[model samples]
Target: MSTVIAYVDGFNLYYGMRAKYGHRYYWLDLAALVRRVRPQDSLVGVRYFTAPVRGEPAAAANQSVYLDALAAHSPAEVETVLGRFAAKRLRCKTCRGPLTCACTPPVSHRTYEEKATDVAIGARLVEDSALRASDVALIVSADTDLVPAIEAAQRLDPARAIYMALPPGHMRPSRHFSTVGYFNINESALRACQLPALVKDAVSGAVYARPAKWH
Candidate 1:
């Protein structure tokens, strides 16, 4: 039996799901979603990498509940790596007037944002590869930022198999690594992995949990 390790990019996947199927679907049981793609003889374990919500109290509380649910549901199968938040410089090009508009000055500002998670994920990939943890690596992300890590892993051990999982309806090839497989969680799969609607948080009261549905 081939062993597969899955690395999920939480933010990338969240936006992808939102882009494909409107706003209602947000809460997702990642472990359950991955199981839908598992082959009978494959699928050893899944590693989910995500950063916690930093500012908003309500949002943070809700996220805590969802994370708790994931842990409670699949204690053995799922492992989560928490990431940090960072400030990034944003360049905004403003447009003036209408169709025959002139380009305004580019504004640069720093905003506190979710930190790059690919670094942690990349480190884990290399670590696992060095230890010969699994037969294949399944990375659930479309961010090309992970190209170096993927290439390094292949260079280290030429036999390690690397695959990609694009979010539903979004497909793109990586600049560095050629994707072997592209797994998209469609509506049917989402339906199979959807979490319960009502979630209780320690800090907040009952919050509405909307799991991503298949579209």
Candidate 2:
């Protein structure tokens, strides 16, 4: 059996799901979802890369709960790797005005961008390939930035199978790299792989519940 490690780009997947399917699918079971997508392989591990919400208290709360639930249920098979959020100033396209614009904005607005998520996913993909951690790497992302990493992994081991599981609503493949085959995340799969409303850790008796808003 081929051993598989799944690298999930959390922000990319989140936005894709939100754009097409909304928040109902947010309470996902990471390991179960990977297994559902790649049933032929032996799922060895899942690495979820994301950045914590900066100012949005509700988002942060929901994310915290979800992460805890994943850990509580699949501590051995799943890992959450966090990135940081950076605030950048928005500029006008026509005049290149810095935040302060006469047309729409009196001042520049701050938009938070997720940092290091793609890099983390890419690095892990290459690292896993180099270390022979798995026979295949299943990437759950649509970001083109990860193409370099996939290319590098192929260079390290041409025999290794690299597959892309595009998030919901994403149709285009990576411009720099190509996989053996790519699959789309469908609503049926997401619905079937959802975590229960609550999960509890037997060792510590800690309970993690899904946020009602996410449903």
Candidate 3:
């Protein structure tokens, strides 16, 4: 059996799912989803890279619960690696001022970028590929920034398979890079692989309820 290790871009998957299906399938089971998508391969692990939601208490609470649920999930070995959000000031091209200055169009506004996640994923992927930790590396994301890492991994292990996997509902493929292959997870998998409404933490035995808003 070919060993497969999945690297998931949590935000990318989240926004895409929200845009396409709303919160109906937010309580997802990462392992089962992977199994549904790659039934023939032996999955070894799943690395989930994400950041704590900021400026939204309800959203952050829900995300925390979901992360805990993933931690307690017995069927899959999932590791949650948190990155961070960095603020960057936006300025109008013409006025070079804040949005208040009022440009004709395309007003500037403060925005935050997710930091460290891509780098962490890239470094880990390259290391794992170089070490031959698994026979296949499954990267799930639409970000083109990952192109260089994927290419480097391929160069490191020419015989190993490196697949660029798009999460369910992602129609457009990243035009930046080529890999050994590309895979698209379907909506059925996302719908069918939801976690239980009440998940008990495997370590603390604390029960977490699904967010009311999610229902």
For TM-score, the strongest prediction is 2
- Model 2 per-residue lDDT tens digits across residues 23-129: 99999999999999999999999999988898799899999889988989999999999999999788878887776656553656778888889888988998888
Which sections of candidate 2 miss by over 4 Å? Answer: 100-108
What is candidate 2's TM-score against the reference?
A: 0.93
**Cα distance off (Å), candidate 1, residue 57:** 2.6
Specify the poorest-scoring 10-residue window by lDDT in model 2: 99-108
Q: All models: lDDT?
A: 0.72, 0.88, 0.83
Error of 3 at 182 (Å): 1.3
Candidate 1 structure lDDT: 0.72
TM-score between candidate 1 and the true structure: 0.77
The C-alpha TM-scores of every prediction are 0.77, 0.93, 0.90
Clashes of each: 1, 1, 0
Ranking of candidates on lDDT, top first: 2, 3, 1
Q: Kindly provide the TM-score of model 3 when superposed on the true structure, using C-alpha atoms.
A: 0.90
In the range 85-163, model 1's lDDT, one tens digit per residue, is 7765554457432232244753444555877599988988888888888888888888888888887777776787888
